[model samples]
Target: DAGITQSPRHKVTETGTPVTLRCHQTENHRYMYWYRQDPGHGLRLIHYSYGVKDTDKGEVSDGYSVSRSKTEDFLLTLESATSSQTSVYFCAISRDRGTGELFFGEGSRLTVL
Candidate 1:
């Protein structure tokens, strides 16, 4: 289970509406990332946090924002979601630099209409 949990596993929202997906981890991992998976794009990074209150933007972060205020919680927000943002969002946790392997959450499916 990786001790990771994503909230609102499925969501449907109208265009221009606000949406927020939560990722909660019990393993106390030091690194966390948010990614969106699509048919052709595969998985694109949205944002990532290395520690509490330390976040960085990634390739597909144009319409998204993220916050990490605690070691166990990371929040990804879409201030104004659009249909183009509809995808399966995944949260991944890594305890090491690149060898410990990543632990992924079930996923949050967001549909914007």
Candidate 2:
């Protein structure tokens, strides 16, 4: 098993409130990424970290931000949520970047009103 999990498997929130999603892994891998899946858009990256305290932004990182303070935990924060941001978020990890073979968590369903 890849040993990754996403929290708040389901969620519903107001349009303008802040929401935070958590990803936990037991694999001790160095690469962790946050992505959101929307209809017709495929998976879009929000943020990713190579190692603890080492992070970088992804293509669709406007309303989202992330932090990785520990090897096994990465957190994604929506500063001010929006209806457009309503999507299923997934956390993924890879043992190596060259292979591009990613293992994804079940996903977090977020509904915005």
Per candidate, the number of residue pairs that clash is 0, 0
**Model 2 lDDT per residue over 11-99, tens place:** 99998999999999999989999999999999999999999999999999998989999999999999899999999999999887899
Worst 10 residues of 1 by lDDT: 95-104
In order, what lDDT does every prediction score?
Answer: 0.94, 0.94
TM-score of each: 0.96, 0.97
Quote the lDDT for 6 in model 2.
94
Q: What TM-score does candidate 1 get on C-alpha atoms?
A: 0.96
Best by lDDT: 1
What overall lDDT, based on C-alpha atoms, would model 1 receive against the true structure?
0.94
Scored by TM-score, the top model is 2
